[model samples]
Target: MKKSLLALTVISTLLPLAACQTASNQVATAQTAEIDDKSEALKLNELTQQYFEASLARNPLMATFVGVHQYDDKFNPPLSAEFIQETRAFEQAYLDKVNQLDASELTGQDWLSYEIFKYDRQHALAGMDFNQEYMPLSQMGGAHTYFAMLGSGQSAQPFNSTQDYREFMQRARGFAEFMDSTIIFMQKGVESGVVLPRPIAEKVLPQLSSHVVEDITQSVFYAPLTKLDSLENLTSEEKSTLQQDYVAVIRDVIIPAYDRVYQYMKNDYLAGTRSTVGLSALPDGNEWYEHKIQTHTTLPLTAEEIHAFGQREVKRILEQMTKVKDQVGFQGDLQEFFVHLRTSDEFYFDSEEEVIEAYTKVKQKIDTRLPALFSVFPKADYEVRAVEPFRAASAAGASYQAPAPDGSRPGIFYINTHNLKAQPKFLLETLSIHEAAPGHHFQIAIQQEVEGLPQFRKFNNYTVFAEGWALYAESLGKEMGMFEDPYQWYGRLVDEQLRAMRLVVDTGLHAMGWSRQQAIVFMLNNSSMSETDVVAEVERYISIPGQALAYKIGERHIRELREYAEDQLGDKFDIRAFHQQVLVDGGIPMPLLTEKIQRWVASQR
Candidate 1:
């Protein structure tokens, strides 16, 4: 890996170092440089290990996700003034050390390592002024929601033994302090003009109420103890002891912690949330938003530029939809055809299992065709599961969770059956390709399986790279001969139009000062999405700014790169190598991706 970084070393060797005229001087310089490089590389690797270990210690829920059990006994305390300052200092020192590393001397995996470290440090430093903790917990999306998932055995939290039970109790006990701090953070947010939009917060109230059962034993979270019979090697006495300990922790620690937060939100924060929309309305709002765009897309595009580009794309996609409308023998224009599809009985699935089965079929077909496009594939297996009910209402239509690096858990593609209408059968094949087969499951798993990449590169993700590839995969319907049916073709266009609408709606809400209602209306006008789907999608854009930009932006980049390769390589271009070049590097900023692809092109030449 280190030698790969120095593929340019021989080129450097031929350059003049005018002062090193003597043989003895050159030998001494070369020997000293070798020792120094090794020393620095070892020091940096140690720092990486230290940081990774500390991160797990600070967030035990994260530890469980990565299959590390040592820190299962603690939860991260809510952000405090002390925490904010210390983290800033920690990142600052880490950045200083990274700046000292000689990246030019590194190659391949080492070069990748240098880039990941630099990018992570620089971005953290860039956001230090944003003060995101002021809105530490939102009813719409925040730590409170994430922690509830942890307590549910279906997630990363363990429920197998007396020791695991005891560990959870210790973690749950910290909830009161965390909730108290959450309130303080939201209170600061209200004073600082960083409140969440009212429409989104109103929707969150129902979810909050659902989670606030008066009896801890009656809560959805209690399913863990009820399902304990599935746990291996546990005797009745141990199970009884674990069950009692869990109920006590939930009743005494967890429930009260939720109640404290619920009351604070109801009494204080809810009333103070802004009736208006947009992050642009907040303090230092423009710059804060620009950072979000750059962070998500890993590109230097301004929101205004993305907004303009979205308008162009919306126009192009709508034209494509018109062609599909004619092919489907729809009697009306594109807009009318959209309305028909949304209300059409044939498009809807009778049950969630049908939707799953449809996707499974897509997977089988796509898997066979994949060999034509690429030589490499993910080693681990993957499965399709319905998104858990508790958070499904707010989750994306279909999302992918990468496998554990050690492969203890298979990758999971969560299909949101929360709204059956949203998961139309027409879109099943496309969605499967996006969230599973050649999309996230393959890309992320292949990256993790890479032998020599740094740990950070394996786990790290750039939203544009990840989401973009998924969106691009959706466009592969024609290539795979799966969009032969006009209805399925329309489904692909509908999904494509949805991404185009996101570009418009997301920029509308965050940049042009559109209300939540306006964003929903725009989506309905342009795409074949139901009102229920439109409302949920708009609220998602509200909670997560600039994230929508990545899909379309990334797809454009990947498609353009493929075109460039075809133009440059002419008959020499290999689809397999093109795919390998893209997926082999995992996720990178689009510019770095271009360079990597160009490097591959040069090698072929």
Candidate 2:
């Protein structure tokens, strides 16, 4: 899936420096000139705001999601070959403009913003070399899924007034155009051998077919009509007109477009899709995989290095699991113990409601204890919801959606109940901590509430920092007094082991040429994850390479920084203050985060 547009807004907030001169004497004069740092900072901030406005003008859906309503009726053209080329060229121009700035002349947050802006442009430009546009749709996340969510009346798209409904009608037209363009891209993918894996293609067919209902009212796209009665701003006549327009759009534009995608996928694309699961099977696969690794982890480690690290982590975690088993006095070897954990009726929930209720209870317990660990808390509150049935079969065990910037929407922690057995009761505490309180909700909401930062900083996410912090939050279960039961402690171990296995499995599949089955077998042999969960995770890695590596790698860096602070400060160490320092600046690259902590440590001394 693409990062949230709110996250991608970093590209829009970059300030371009004055054009550079080629002459040596002019260059020396420019370099030597006394620049007013404060004046330049003001100029930079103004430029960033202007750029953000320009970006919102072009990306309508993004503007809507971020609470900028001016462009809510617009949508970008399809990702056609020409569109991709144009976008790359545009990014390169901005990159060149920013490159003219001297980082040494900036200070504090001004310098931080400059570095972030440069990083965003350069990373985006580099990715343009890969043919990601060709394979635009995936079972993991794609236009098909996101459009359904937006039209479902339960997502970021607002449906509060008649104008909102009318704007979405225009958006529905744009969605049809977008789907047509997707078909074009898939055709190009077929010719270039840049198609999705066969399994993913298979999964996508059912998703598309689900939307092809005979009755217009049954369509997810027709959901707005059902909601018209709730809009007090609309007249009875206006509501009737809106309902008629919705029916016409859903019957003529939306469903037909979905049918087009469905027919093409079932008849043409599936035959061309690759059976090989690894990215290494594609053209320039090695370079593509390497870029993803660096992009996701923001670290210099190679596939081989990450694989070796994962091996060591797996071994160490197994030892911890053995101790847990011994303490519980379970008979049989570790493999048998895994079976016991999987099959025991006690570990499984009877219903989806039970699973949600379990998480709610965990949240209530953790809420009281959070004050001891953090000095800062988000003004935004969060709630837990079960994953929607349409996508839950292929979704992660759990995932988080950050709260809206305007606080109109709360952060959501979606627990997948596709296979309840995959969600063991022992895993509930650790999962709750990671996805909810003091995890994504805490970190992301705090970032949104941060004052004086650029909009990009408030909304942007680095996978390593975000996912890593969540994993680090899981370790806080011990400090928060929630892991008293030996079984719950074992849940923490199992969770950690999952991350450890990701490091190995992600590398194994992408770099080492391991098959999908090989990766699944490796995970099952090493951890207590169900075969159902293991298969989903392995396929997830296959679908999105190198993303899985961020968790353990990010947690390791965070834990190391915390340990360094403690070792240096001794009795003066304040966990709350340390957490505040880490979170106050919002999500950043791992190296920058380390530097920020090191500076804090120095000031304390």
Candidate 3:
């Protein structure tokens, strides 16, 4: 699944030089022609503005996620024939207009802007045939997590206002139709063998049923109203009216809507769900799997090639892991040491608060060393928070939610505490580096804060580039004077091995026909991760094809780029400036990213 698009016959790949146009002539022409570059920049900005407005008009839930409130009460229409047709037309128009622009005429930030903008537009169009909606609402992609976000009273949805309450009621009405459509899609999955695994289906039933309660006041969605009284501007009378309306919406609409979907899954869907391992089992599985690879990597590597690479990486990381064994003075072979890390108390936190604190300490430690590695830093402040109780069971060991670009909220690094054993103290430094400080927070915040780049470039993501950079940041621990503690250093290697394992286990499960249990066994045998972690990671691979491959593959590319730059530039190379160049322009595809770095290296020379 993590393989390149060229590996499958679904889409054609373009040469890098052909896909990109030169900017020098365009820059000079813009300097003296009918308009200045700033005016040309506005065209891209206007397109972004139009795009966002169109998206909000179509999908209100997406609006809420981005801190846009006007659409808080609406859900986007179901993925249907009409939706697909309209989206295709929109993308085609944008691509046609973008191609007309002379990108070679632009330079500096403008050139970076042109490249990223064109890439995303083309990439979005590339996966048109995949039909993501065909197999949506799994344990991973369900709206269940999103509903919890709104109910938490801490996100963008306003619970204190009457208008907000009224719009939410409207949303409840909209959701009923969405659930119906989701069931239709799931039913289609049943027919196509694209259904969720039996284990995951059983795991998700409870979560869906939790929202099916008859009383709105008792629902998780009602927690916002319980906190409404604390808002200073809300008078008791206004609060009462809002609360009453919210309850009606939930009782009369939302609960029943949730109930309908829950009943369908419990009674009808579960019995028919698939027990298969990969996307290859689905209709046109080859094409869909290929699309996922291209979408994630933004490159043209084949599945067989990726599978072979994963085999090599896993072997490589395991060898590095032996050094961890020696450093810690463990008295056994690697497997036995992995067992000790699993069973031993020295590697784990006594409480969830301790997990949070470990990450906090890592942030402080990494902050002092960041200057040594690079000059660029994100302006937005970030905080570490525990993953909310309900979702933590299935959440990643740690994940990041980027702050709203408008500065309405701070970036949050959510550390999962559901299974304490999985959140070992040994992994804190690497986890913190990858998820917070120099990892996602730095990359995402710096991208958002970058000026003179097209708006799309600011938010668009490439898995190889984004996740790879985060994984590579973990290697900075030694440079930052960390990993000095042999056990902690082992944590770094273990984390690296986990990514490497993804390459092996993911391809093994999807491409090589390994069962879910087989994939878990492969990870358990290779790494020091907990059994719970092994199961979760294996399931995650199943739920999201090709996503697992991005972490290590991307990290490897960034490392290679750094090594190449150091070798090429020699005395002229500046690590801080290299970092600045990487972060200042936001995320790019690995190939294009390398080109930009080479340009910067040349500029320094």
Candidate 4:
């Protein structure tokens, strides 16, 4: 599962104020409390800022993406023993400092920040207790993939200045060092039973080898050199020198670094990798998976519970699909209709342009319709883009990138056109709505734009909130008066079934002793998803345990809250205001979100 920068835990309790002996004494007590609260809030705010700045400095790549440029030149190898120890120390020291503050007097945003900070610190320390650095990189993601994306010239790393060029060079050197560190860890993993699965290692080989090139210009790392004209002050000699630096790095540093890891992975690491695919295969893997489930869902849920819930959800969705199947007057049974949907070219896009145009249409239509259900829309609009070619095949069918806080970059909804079968035509409306407007774009951009919120709350992502909200947004299509065609409605069920299936498949892979094929077959049997899409999705869950559960787990919670709102408020419920209540706080934990909504519902009553 994808995680944001921060985690929240523990709600604060109000400190009991002094009992007044008389009216004058009451006034005196109130005055003293006000002064104390102000002082405490100021200290809390300062500590949050201090922590944020320190966090940025520690994770320079994150800083670069978040528009903090001071750390643009700094690159830290995240997997190094020294880095992990330092990070643990950093979080602990700040956590101790935060604990010293008087949260009793803090209220409103101040109180929320204090609580989120404490949770973020404590939860982070808890998660860090796992030996994650041992199995760091996956074909799905890691420093290797992120580093490649940064070098591609299309990512957040800016290649706009001479300083930028030099900084990237420094980053490249750090990457080389990172490769060495990765090898050290993998060797450690080999000695222990903590290695990547054999299949995962096999998949990573091509990705790593793609970076190693005999010709320097073919290197993804050499992409920045092509755009040197964008640099203003550089003379021909300066440009020539920068070009040489890039070539040298690609030839001597970057490519060799890739080759070293690629060779090791192919020859050495592959043999050491586990034949069994699940986290259960490794030592303490079940504990790690359990922690991941709690961390991602931000609820005390088990694999068994989520798996059973997923089965119920799947059955419910299938019943709806049956109704749609009969409504569409399909000639066959539900399974046959699923096969028809998967096989029919009418449901698949012919070309990438057609797909992008379809999403563009969705953007135009959904943007106008949003006002009916929402009072708050992001100030930043999102663009629909193809996943870059290098990563497209392995990337998710579609994903969203949040817009820059200062409005420098628009949110990007990446549609993977690499596998057109994965982007079925009937599912376009639901997919676009979920990945773009009122989904990730609204949730993320709005989070970034939430006024006076601390940095962590603004940027820290909760997978359950983010993914769940997106899945919930997909359901709003019927409310928006789209999906009138039964096939389109079936498309929504298909999308939902994908998430519901995740709950079962994720748990199955980690906890149920499932083979990779068994997970794939189970998903194919359960949903109308193309085998291509099912394979990718199952592999993704295998790579990252407990992440896929976030969508349904989160969606169900938010939807339940909405249903509760509608039931309790009756005719008085305001959909727009309820959405604002859910979203305006940005990404909150499920319990916090429920409490917030209940509080809103009570106020409305």
Residues 1-605 of candidate 1: C-alpha lDDT, one tens digit per residue: 00000111111111110011133233333433343446556655655555555545555555666667887777665557766665565566567767877776666656666677778778876877886777655434555665676677765667776677788789777656677887888788889888877776666666666667777767766877777787788898978888887887777777777778778777787899887778788888778889889877888898888888888888898898889888768898877887888888888988888878877777788888888777889998788888778877766687776676677778877788888988888887777888788887888789889876656566566788888888898887788778888778878888788888888888888888899888888888888889988887788777767778888899999999999999999999998889888998777888788877888898898
Model 4 / residue 222 / CA error / Å: 2.9
- TM-score of structure candidate 3: 0.90
* lDDT of prediction 2: 0.80
Per-residue accuracy of model 2 over 5-115 as CA lDDT, tens digit each: 222222221111101112322333343243335465665565455445545555666666666887566555565655555555555655665676767777778877877
Tens digit per residue, CA lDDT, model 3, 1-605 = 21111001011111110111123223323433333355556665565555545544555665565557887777655545565666665666656666777776767766766677677678778777665665556565455556566656666566666677777778767767777787888887788677777777876777678777755567777777776666677777877877787778778777787788889889999899878868777777777778788777877877788888888878988888888788768899989988888998877888988888878888888888888998888888788888776666666777777777788788888888888898888887888888777988899888888876665566556777778888889988888898887778878888888888888877777777789888988899999888888888888888778888888888878888889899988988888887887788888888788888888777777
TM-score for all predictions? 0.91, 0.93, 0.90, 0.92
Per-model lDDT: 0.73, 0.80, 0.72, 0.78
Model 1 CA deviation exceeding 4 Å by range? 1-44, 215-217, 230-235
State model 1's lDDT: 0.73
TM-score result, candidate 1: 0.91
Candidates ranked, most accurate by lDDT first: 2, 4, 1, 3
Per-residue lDDT, model 3, residue 554, is 88
Q: How much is the lDDT of residue 27 in candidate 1?
A: 39
Alpha carbon lDDT at 310, candidate 4:
90
Q: Give the TM-score of candidate 4.
A: 0.92
